[model samples]
Target: MKKTTETLRGNYFFKQDELIYVNRNDENFVGPFHDHDFLEIAYIVEGEGFHHIGESVQKVRKGELFYLPIGISHVFRPKSTSGQKLVVINCLFSPNLLPKLIAFASEKPTVDFLWRMRDGLLSNYSVRDRNDRFERLFQSMFEQYSTRAPGCEDMLHALLFQLMVELHRSMRESENTDQSLPKEAAFQDLLHYLRNNCEQELTLSHLAHLSGFSERHLQRLFHQHTGQSWFKYWQSVRVRRSSELLLRTSDKIQHIAEAVGYKDIHSFNAVFKRLTGLTPSQYRKRE
Candidate 1:
């Protein structure tokens, strides 16, 4: 990935509530492990290196794909003195933007593999060749991403569907390799509760009781699945909602704070500044 100091020459892009960055990386660059609120997929257009994902590490080369579950801490960089060239495309999207069927299917590979790929799975499929017609689909996706046009959302959807189909075919060819766990269903239920009740006064005990787990167990589950504590995750949800309100509405800062369950405007301002590096008023004005 390009450093913050690098100047981008192309019309690099971002979507409403989503982001995509395509960049080239030189050798010996290491990014710190971090996690965020969006799912990430990285396609290696070229290069060879080691990718550290959760507890698993693997060598990644050209035409390889890596899936990062939302909020899973990981890092990727060159691993050898020879270094490597990399063309990286990173796409981040909110879970709310996904279709209901797709969202539900994400918890079960029996269904989800047909629609999407889960985290921690790497395939060595040759996406550069059209010998079996599979490369044609990849080429179409590459073209759609490279030359985004009007109604590109439709194009992106089609390309994503094609990519999923190719991955599903690969999974079937490999004898339906089962690598993901079934814990996503329970996690999804917990997340749904959190999203619905974000505006209410919530506590660890309350959330634990609602999710049918003890407080400690709930914390562990959240850390395992999302790579963050429940409190920090909930704070991110509040910050994101507050950011939306700040951008789109004329609501007062205090009111926006209250709407997201912060009773004290001072505390809200402090936390908001800590997370976003801007005062609420400043954020709104900049937006």
Candidate 2:
């Protein structure tokens, strides 16, 4: 038997850089397939279940970790008729938060690892191995969440760094890797343009001009590499920024909308509903 709950109600918890949620499930529960923009790492603290990442399905047990890249679809549920007990640490992190990590790896070496990992490359590491250093790090992270002490953010960052290092190591050990490099130089330029001028009305023509690509060529390249059109991608960035305002500030919806590049609330509302299935006011209520 599987059960479902709208745990966070809405995406209000992660308006800023990211949000962390610790979930304890004491009954048989199954999640419908879903995906999000931020990276997700799930640590199964107890019991056994089947996890579906992309097209591959595998059994996940206590002390095991599941890593999901941005926009990757995944689902997990108990493997038995009886209920199961499990603890899941859900971490949402911005891709921009780890520039140093990405830059350190050669573009060819890293993209292959990232692509394979996205395709369900499970590691031999066990989450229940209490002796494992990474397990200890997770325990410490759980403690920080529990205590909410001063300097918790610093502690969390340290733990996250350690976790990333371990994941990178695991990635290196995987075989049949695809080591082709991405057009990172061009992508970085696009990132800079988006960050600096998010407030201004931006268009594909403007972005293509800034990136030194013809508008049609830029559209083809962006879609082929990033899986989204320029307009759709920029809207995602704006909506993410707007979510932060809605969660952390008392700014009016119209004001928040404008701050994120929308000049009209109606347009903002339509886009918000399309992305999150909730109007700004409805989303605010969930918060």
Candidate 3:
């Protein structure tokens, strides 16, 4: 049986309040050339097929993720009608959210990806999800779209952000050295540095110098990934490290405070109590 590939516009597909559509589909054969008014991310879940995008036809297997920007006509054709079934998960979202995506994206590749779409410069491209990480995230968005729970819209948007960032990371890992994002290396390195070096009195100015970002930009970067301000993130890291010391080591509370970068016991006790709702000594007692 032949399949139809005439996808209707946004109004025909999306629901009210929740404007995204997600479905796991089976493709039987090649369909007519069709374009969409919205953006799409298609994850091939099972079987093999060929994707006809723009002027290219690429052999696509399971774990291949494709990006289809608006107005890009494309179709999927299964390799054979009698072979293993071709399963795909298609996620369609409105173009209205692209502005927000461009605004909140902290890295270059992501902004580059969205800009390519905005300027009509993007050709459809596919990436391989070697780790099955994308499969899990796609499943999550599928479930969230299905359930439509409280804050479902916000959750799906957040998950979409996660998916894009993951796509960027996978791209970086797959790129040759010359094709990499040079100075704007993923903010992941700086995040790890902060988590690993909580003992130092790390300042925003210092971190900004290291990351080649303005102090304000670095603060926004911190909030983007850690959901906390610079001072709060550093404080939380310090407090959490102190908790581990409190539980694992025989160090005195005053020494633990100093070890985690606090100059005095009083300040450490204040932050620890506020964060844990227990004084350091009381927390130790509970354990």
- Write candidate 1's Cα lDDT for 180-231 as tens digits: 3224444566786776566898899987777667889889888987789999
Worst lDDT 10-window in candidate 1? 2-11
What CA root-mean-square deviation does each model show from the true structure? 20.5, 19.4, 10.5
Candidate 2 stretches greater than 4 Å from native? 1-11, 15-30, 100-131, 175-287
The per-residue C-alpha lDDT of model 1 at residue 220 equals 89
Q: Write one digit per residue (lDDT tens) for candidate 2, span 132-196.
A: 44556677777876687998766766676677666665444343254422244455558656754
Question: How big is the positional error of residue 41 in model 2, measured in Å on the Cα after superposition?
Answer: 1.4
**Positional deviation of 8 in candidate 1, in angstroms?**
46
Q: Identify the leading candidate in terms of TM-score.
A: 3
Q: Rank the candidates by TM-score, best first.
A: 3, 2, 1
Error of 3 at 9 (Å): 1.0
Between prediction 2 and prediction 3, which has the larger TM-score? 3
lDDT of 3 by residue, 161-184 (tens): 788788767666656476335434
